[model samples]
Target: MFFKSSKINEFRLWGLLFTLFGMGLMILGTSGIVFWGQAGKWFAGVFMVIGMIAMLLSVGVYFWAGMLSTSAVILICPECNRHTKILGKTDRCMYCKTKLTLDPNEATDLDEGITEKA
Candidate 1:
């Protein structure tokens, strides 16, 4: 299976990517600046629509990531034995894919959750 980072880290990385994508779109939309008046408005309008969409999406992603962070639980990775944070009911080791458990009743390898292990 492909390696995956902890849920929290993935969210953060996604948020950063969304922000950059929005900024890039906004920059591209401003290409009309060179033409000054004639074509600027038309180009700016077309670019602005797409750019605004990207920026709004980025803002939403950032907000969601921030909200998700509030519930993240800090734990020690079993494989690497290093301290790391994981989100949701299931998660994997930040450094290594060793299974972890929050509840004593449940088995170490949870069938469903965010991460595969601690």
Candidate 2:
């Protein structure tokens, strides 16, 4: 069977995961409030703190992903001639299983090719 790929899949997955995490954190924070009324001070405080940390992390992840989406380089795959965005130190061609590079001079370094392994 042939496999088809979609653009923005990774970013969308990250976004969905982060959003779910944020929602979960909000639920936990609400639980913490309820616990504060029942459980002793220390436990409730800990729960609230942990929930807040989760929320902050989720937000940071979402913001960072947004920045990455904007900054990621778009490339037309030489193998398939399909357009795709490359992110970070490495990425993959969404259409073809061909290795790609962000820097032509550093192309020899498989490790340095931003789209070497994708």
Best by lDDT: 1
Q: Which stretches of candidate 2 lie over 4 Å from their true place?
A: 1-37, 40-42, 78-81, 94-99, 105-118
Candidate 1 lDDT at 58 equals: 71
Model 2: per-residue Cα lDDT at residue 90: 50
What TM-score does each of the candidates earn? 0.66, 0.49
Whole-model Cα lDDT per candidate? 0.71, 0.62
The residue pairs in collision within model 2 are 92-118
**Candidate 1 segments whose C-alpha is farther than 4 A from its true place:** 1-3, 35-37, 95-118
Question: Using alpha carbons, what is the TM-score of model 1?
Answer: 0.66
